[model samples]
Each structure stands twice: as C-alpha cells, then as structure tokens.
Target: MIQLKTREEIELMYESAQLVSKTLGILAKEVRPGVTTLYLDKIAEEYIRDHGAVPGFLGLYDFPNTLCMSPNEQVVHGIPNHKPLKDGDIISIDCGALKNGFYGDQAFTFAVGTIDPEIDKMMRITRQSLYAGIKKCKVGNRIGDISFAIQLICENAGYGVVRELVGHGLGKEMHEDPQVPNYGRKGSGPKIEEGLVIAIEPMVNLGTYKVKFHNDGWTVTTRDNQPSCHFEHDVAVVNGEPKLLSTYKYINEALGITSNEEDEFLYNFMHD
Candidate 1:
C-alpha cells in the first residue's frame, strides 16, 4: 500500500533527500578521468556517515557498495570496481541515504571528461525527460501520466526506454509502493495524491531497449552494447502540485553549469 507521509514526516524526508543530494555533489567533484569508482564509493560512504546519515545502499540486500556506478552501456546496479574512468566515458552514480527513519534516493549520469557529442545529447535528453515526467506528478494525475510523458520524449528522440527497471514510491523504505515506469498509457495506474513521495527515474538507452543481466547478479547492460543514460529525482505532491525534495544545485555548481530548469518544481520551503 502507498503510505502517504505527514507534514512532519515530509520534513524529515526532505532532510534525508538533501543528504543524498549533497553526497552526489561531492562525488561530482571527484568524478574524472583516472578516478576509480571504488575510490569514489569510499569517499561517498565517509561523507554520508560524517553527516550523521547511514549509507543507504551499502549492504542493502547483501549488495556491497555505497553507490551504484554504471558506466556506458550498463543500465543500472553496476558494482563499483578498481577500474579507472577514462576520458569520454560517462558514469551514472545512483546514491541513497537513510536519515530520521526515511530514505532519499537519486541518480545522475556524469561525463568523465570530454565525451562523444551523440552520447552527450542522449544524456541531456534523458535528464530532460525526467523533468517532463515530474511535471505530470500532480494530485489529479495518474502515475501513467508521468510515465507517458517520459516515454514520449525519449521515444521521439529515437532513444530506448528501459523496461525491466522502474522508479518507486519512497519513504521509510528505499523501495515502496507505486512502481513508476517510464512508459505507459495515459489515465492508467494509481491516481497520484497529496503527501505521496516518489522517485522518478528515466533510464534511456542509445540503442535497443533490450537489456541483459550480467553473471555478477548485480550489473545490467544493454543487449546492443550501446550507451545509456539515467537521471532521477525525488518528488512529492503538496497543495495539489508537485514539489521537488532534492536539488541538483550542488552538482551543477561543481560542473560550473547554470540552469534554472528545476525552478518550476522548487518548493517554497527549499528557499528557506
């Protein structure tokens, strides 16, 4: 069942979400050519712990890592390793944090250095699709509204939206009710309501949407061996509108990027 959060509970969740967002910002500065994902993972764990929140992904379901680091063709759930990232490679770092009995989850695909223009465009489109989906997360809309929005954008661009993986409602648990898929028919699925918080993620592949599981039982990669991009956000419905609980300001600052793309989704409390 979907557990709607109370106002106080939502406040606590905001704190948890910010912690994860901050962790991603720190990783942003460390993501570069010659940097190993395992090394970045270590730093992320320390940073999250130092801030008084536990690393949400480490040891969860016996998976060993503070972050899910997937590069290039790998879709998600890639385990951290000693392999150093190279120039032109893009890595998707999905992070989480547990604080005050709540969980915050988010992800971003970062370019190690200079990357292929086509790959870069794919990333941009995938990230834009995330917001498109978020824009539909209102009190009267169904989950399918959000899904269809994301799917239409990426599909029109000739990108493949991953089917095996889907976004989920989040609160005390990392994965909760209301699976948010990237593709669906409109007016279908559960109706969105106030106090409902969820993670909307779009995983788009540059080639076919078909993916294969690796033998490690964790990593997932595209069957056509083409690059993929993933972007995510934590959103909540309040006062009949969608409000963002996480911000990319830190990441953008680290990358020296200036964009107000998220301005429409920022909640009033975010400014305070």
Candidate 2:
C-alpha cells in the first residue's frame, strides 16, 4: 500500500532532508583528487550523528558503508574504499539520514577535478532529467508520467536510463509503496495523490542501460563499462503540486555553480 504522509510528517522528513542537503554542502568542499571516499563517508557519518541523527544507510541490509560512492562506470551503491579519487574522475555520492523516525536520501555525481568533457556533459544531462521527472509529480498525474519524462529527457540526450533500479515512496521507512521506475508507459502505475512523498532519482549512463551487480552484494556498475551519473531529491505532493523538501543549493555553493534551475520548484522561501 502507498503510504501518504501528513503535512506534519512530511515536514519532519523535510528536516532530515535538509540535513542531508547541508551534509552535501560539507562534502562539496572536500571532494578533490587524492581524497578517499571512505574519508568522506566518515565525515558524513560523524556530521549526521553530531546533529542527532543516524546515518541511514550504514549497516542497512548489512551494507558496510555510510554512503554509496560510485565513480564513473559505477552507477550506484558503490562501496567506500581506501582507493583515492584521482583528478578528472567523477563519483556519485548518495547520502541518507534518519531523523524523527523518517529517512531522507539524496545523491549527486561530482567532478573530482577538470573531468573529460563528455563525462561532464553526461552529468549535466542526468541532473536535468531529474527535474524533468519532478515536473510530472503532481496530484493528478500517474507515476508513469514521471517515469516517461525522465526517460525522454535522457534518451534524447543519448544517455542510457537505468532499468532495474527504481525510486520509491519514502516516509517512516527507507523504501515504501508504489515503485517509481525511470521507464514506464504513460498512465500506468499508481496515480499521484496529495500527501504522497517520494524520492525521485535518475541514474543515467553514457552508454548502455544495462548494469552489473558486484559480488559484494552492494555495488552496481554499468554493464558497458561506461560512465554513469546519478541525481536524486525528496519531494512531496502538496496542494496538487510537487514540493521539493531537499535543495541542491549546498552543492551548487560548494562548486561555485550559479543557476536558477530550482526557481520554479521552490515557493516557501526566496532563493538564488
């Protein structure tokens, strides 16, 4: 069953979401050549705990890391290791936090330094597709609308949209009802309804859409061995529209990137 969140519950989730947002801000400044993902993971774990919350992904399903640090061809669930990041490599940093009994999860692919132009373009397109999907999340649209939007945006850009992994409804638990896939026919899946909260994530690849799961039972890498990018956000259906509880402002600030990509999606407060 799809669990619809009350406004109060969504607000609580928002607080946790914002903490992850800020945590990303902290990581943005630290992502560079020679930095180990495990180091970053420790930083995130300590930061989340210091703020009175638990690292949502740590030990969940017996997984060993606090964050999924996938680099280049690694799509998602990349385990944090001592291997140091190199100049021009891109890694997707997916984070989660548990606060007030709710979970907030978000992900971003970063350029360690001056990355290859083609890989950077993949990152840009994948991030754009995330918003395209978010635009379809409203009170009346079916879940397929969001799925199709994401597929169209990335496929047209010549990027591969991951097939097996999908986003999910989120509230008291990490994964909830109503599977939200990146590829679906219009009008299929559950209808979007008010008070529904979901994590809309798009994992796009530079080559084939197929993926291979590592034997470690956690890491997932692209089948074509081509670079992939992942972006995510937590949103809620409110007043018949999708309201984003998480913000990318921190990441933008860390990278010194300036854009109004989020203007249309925000309302409650003024933003750059």
Candidate 3:
C-alpha cells in the first residue's frame, strides 16, 4: 500500500529533506582531489549528528557509512574507502538523514576537479533528467509518467538508463511504496496524488545500461566499465502541484554555480 503523508507530516519531512540537502552542500565544498571518501563520510556523520538527526544510512541494512560514495564507473552503493580521489574523476554521493520521525534521501554526482568533457555532459544530462521526472510528479499523473519523462531525455542523448535500481516513495520509513523506475510506458503504473512524496532519481550510464553487482553485496558498477551519473531530489505533491522538498540551491551556492533549474518547482514555503 502507498502510505500518503498528511500535510503536517509533509512539513516535518521537508525539514528532514532539507537537512540532507544542507549536508550535501557542506560536502560539496570538501569534495576535491586527494580527499578520501572515508574522510568525507566521517564529517558527514558528525554534521548530521551535531544537527540533531541520525545518520540514516549508517547501520541501516548493516551499511557501515553515512554516505554511499561511488566514483567513476561505479553506479551506487559503493562503500567509502581510504583511497584518495583524483583530478578528472567524478564521484556520486548518496546521503540520507532521519529527523523528527521522517527520512530524507538525496544524491549528487560531483566532479573531483576538472573532468572529461564527455563525462561532464553525461552528468548534466543526468541531472536534467531528474528535473524532467520531477516535472511529472503532479496529482493525477501516473508514476510511469515520471519514469517516461526521465527515460526519454537520457535515451535520446544516447545514454543508458539503469534498469535494476529505482526511485521510491519516502516518509517515516526510508524506502516506501510505489517503486519509481526510470524506464516505463508513458501512462502506466500508480497514479500520483496529493500527499504523495518520492525520491526521483536517474542513474544514467555513458555506455550500456547493464550493471554488475559486486560480491561485496553493496557496490554496483556499469557492466562495460564506463562512467555513470546519478542525481536525485525529494518531491511532494501539494495542492495538486509538485513541490520540491529538497533543493540544490545550497550546493550551487557553495560551488558558486548560478542556475534556476529548480525555480518552477519552488513553492512559497521554500523561500521562507
């Protein structure tokens, strides 16, 4: 069953979501060549705890770290390690936080320093695909509508949409109902409605969509050993329109990036 959130519950979730967003923004400044993923994970845990929330990923499903750090060809769930990041490499950081009985989940693929132009293009397209899916999250639209919107954009750019993994509804529990796939028919799946909140993410690959699950039971990498990008946002339907519970504004500000890609999804409360 899809557990819809109440208006009060959604408000609480917004706080949780923004905490994750702020955490990502903090990490954005620290992500650079010579920094170890394990080091990044350490600070993230401390920050989340210092802010009065628990690290949602750590010890959840026995996962050891606060962040899932995937670099280069790795897709997601790559455990943080001691190896230092290098220039020209990209790393995807997926984070979660639990606050006030709610959970927030979001991810971003970051350039370690200067990266390959083709890889940068793939990252931009993947992030754009995330917005495309968010644009379809209005009341009465089917979950597949969001999926189709995401799929069309990436595939048209000659990128591969990951098939095995998916986005999902989120609230008190980390993973909720209504699995939101990245590839589906335009009108298929569950109808979106008010109170529906989901983490809409797109995992796009530079080569084939096929992925290899590592024996460690966590790491996932592109089968062809090519780079992949992942971007995510937390969105909720309010008064029949889609509102973003998560924002990249903090991250953009930290990086000195000025873009209004999320302006259309901004509801009034976000500004205050």
- lDDT per residue (tens digit) for residues 1-272 in model 1: 99998878888988999999999999999999999999999999999999999999998998899999999999999999999999999999999999999999999999999999999999999999999999999998999999999999999999999999999999999999999999999999999998999999999999999999999999999999999989999998888788888989899999999999999988766443
* C-alpha local distance difference test of each model: 0.94, 0.91, 0.95
Tens digit per residue, CA lDDT, model 3, 1-272: 89998888988999999999999999999999999999999999999999999999999999999999999999999999999999999999999999999999999999999999999999999999899999999987899999999999999999999999999999989999989999999989999998999999999999999999999999999999999999999999998889999999999999999999999998566443
Please list the residue runs of candidate 1 whose C-alpha ends up more than 4 Å from where it truly belongs after superposition. 270-272
Among residues 3 or more apart in sequence or in different chains, the pairs in candidate 1 whose N, CA or C atoms overlap within 3 Å are: none
Q: How big is the positional error of residue 244 in model 3, measured in Å on the Cα after superposition?
A: 0.5
Clash totals, every prediction: 0, 0, 0
- For 1-272, candidate 2 gives per-residue lDDT tens digits of 99998878888898999999999999999999999999999999999999999999998888798899999899999999999999989999999999999999999899998999999888888888889899899977999999999999899989899999999999888989888899888888899998999999999999999999989898899999999999999988888888888999999998899988887777362221
Model 3: lDDT to the true structure: 0.95
TM-score for predicted model 2 compared with the true structure = 0.97
